[model samples]
Target: MHETKMKPTINITRLQSTFDVSSSIGTTEKGGLTRLALTKEDVKIRDVFVEWLEEAGLAVKIDDLGNIYGRREGKKKEAGAVMIGSHLDTLPKGGRFDGILGVLSSLEVIRTLNDLNIETDRPIEIVNFTNEEGERFTPPMQGSGVITGNYDKEIIYKLKDKDGISFEQSLIDSGYLGDIKNRSSNVDYFIETHIEQGPFLEENQKDIGIVQGVKGTKRHRVQIKGKSSHSAFPNSHRKEALLAASEIVLTIDEVAKQFEDLSTSIGVFDVTPSVESITTEFVEFTFDARHIDNAIKDQAIRLIKEKINEVSIKRKVEIDFEETWDANGTYFSKEIMKSIEEAVESNGYSHQYITAPALHDAKFMTDITKTAMIFCPSKDGLSHCEEEYTSIEDIEKVTNVLLRTVISLANQN
Candidate 1:
């Protein structure tokens, strides 16, 4: 067993102050935030992080992708570092503690270690990954995706927002376009602390959640084309794209219900020339599906495709399905997971092994290193909105667990 000379303590007051500082940058009317990646608000938060890190005497570095790293050197410089972090960007009007909590909690862990003057064999790093929300970008997890070789830097740089501004331009505008290499292949382990974003923990009365894995997600765009006609015309032989789209949506819901532990939804449904007098000529909708099992997820996709085809043929409308994004389910490292469990047990916190239904940067980090996550309860299971919240008491509990786990990993051989 790795021995500790002194037990570290997390400063809840300091943590709250840090949250106040970051949340102030993108305050919304509804008390949420809108700090999109690479935006001015995001840059302000990054600058604050750099200041805090430097004040703690940790060496700070920013990569080309604008990933901020605060490193605490160890006795063994050759040993791989234990990387811990989450993204800082939030969805539009997003809650203050979704991804931001993870990053700030990791900083708290580092701060606690510093206060104790604790040194481990392996270096410890707190990373603030850029664009984990991907609200502006098409796909999320861009920062970790780049580091894991899932995305090319050139392509990511060219990605444009709704405003037609390129990602490169935004980074440059924010003054965070660093020259440091974006890739880190030598990460010994990775851990992220985040809000549960669901009601499971709160409902179960657990203080901590040791996340076992993340569910896979598949996003697709479905377009239906049909002839336009006057609404007053006879409806018997008319091809209506909107009608076909409605049928497809119902079919998707039915198919999702057929499988256990599956989620499917059509978040966006658009009809062209949306006038009450004209029959719909074209319709487009986005399909999002997720499942913990790959086989189940694939089966659901197949069923949806078959249903769409059937609907198209019956409605006499041409349909096209375009796959927009896909990410397979990821399981965390067994060793790291065990360490977290141990930390929870040692800290006398009630915890349960859980799976993350929403996508996270830790899913991508698994590609390059052993990764795991710690989750605290969110009130009412609300996230990505202004109502999302987790009590400060819960935050403090999880932060302690995270600190213990980090200490354990840093001292490991």
Candidate 2:
């Protein structure tokens, strides 16, 4: 009988230093980063990641959507690589650890391979997906979405930032346009190390989270149209879009309360006839709903639509629902989930299998290949803000788990 061999372990200090280096790319006064997509911060951070990749002695490449890949060779050259990483882009005034942790942790993995001189049967690739924050762009996970054929290059070429700069222009500006390969199919398994971005682990007294599933999301641009009127003439005879919008917002809140696992919020809205003296003729608002179960998510969205119609009827307004983006729920493979569980146990760290309420690039990659995620706890359950954080000790714990899992996956046939 053949015996299973062990792989080399990663260095904790090196991983911590990698985290420091990336965090330094777009450092803000508030102890966070502001590396919005396609901005100068993005270029600076991409260059930093590329430099580290080269320093680790790995061959680095950039994809069409500006996704970065750093590869370390293995014993079997033809075998598919084991890819692990997250995004490098950050939201406006975002935390330091959210997406950066996964990228830096993967870098640490490659650095460990270089230090130990240990080669596996399959290569390992560290990926830094572009514009995962969706802050500058419309939908988040733009790079992964395009790579997985969710959207076409023409659409990518059309996407522009607030400054009216096209995404294609940004790609060219960043010097990333090249004949990049479709490395998605080349990956046999994918792993992401991330901060939990929630309080589940901390509340449960755990150090890490073995992600069981990621929530599917539906984003809607709901428009409530009503006749504009004078502010002093507050009567049923006069139609007001603001009132209709207020009622619809309340209805959305009510719809959210109907489910245990469902979540709903309005992130952005715009009103026409913008003045204190007059009522608005049109009101446009956004609806963001997420759920682990498809059935519940669908029902919740349906109920929101029903309420929107109700408000429109009561206020004599016209309502229209425009879908911005609706992505299906995603699940990680059992083998990879088990690897995370075992890694946590082997390291004596307490963990739990939790559902990710926030969406990620991993959700999009599920269509291309098997995906799994590891999470460290966020302090105060904060994310997408400058206050979002995970302690360095906690970061190291999750990176160690990621290292073990990646080494094991790289050795698989």
Off by over 4 Å in 2: 1-9, 182-184, 234-236
- Summarize candidate 2's per-residue lDDT along 1-413 as a digit string, tens digits: 11135534577777777777777878888888999886888898888778888888888887788888888877888898888999988987788888888998888877776776667888888888888988898777888888888878788778888889999898899887644573445888888889888888988989989888898888899887789777888586878888898988988888889898788889888999898989889989898899888888999888888888788788898888998878777778889998888778877889888888888888877788888899889888999888888888898788878877877788887
Tens digits of per-residue lDDT, candidate 1, 111-223, equal 88877778788998889998998889867888888878899989999999999999889888988887756445568999999999889999999999999999899999999
Best lDDT among the predictions, by candidate number: 1
- Residue 51 in candidate 1 has what lDDT? 95
Global local distance difference test of model 1: 0.89
> What are the lDDT figures for the candidates, one per model?
0.89, 0.83
RMSD of each: 1.8, 2.4
TM-score, predicted candidate 1 vs. hidden true structure? 0.95
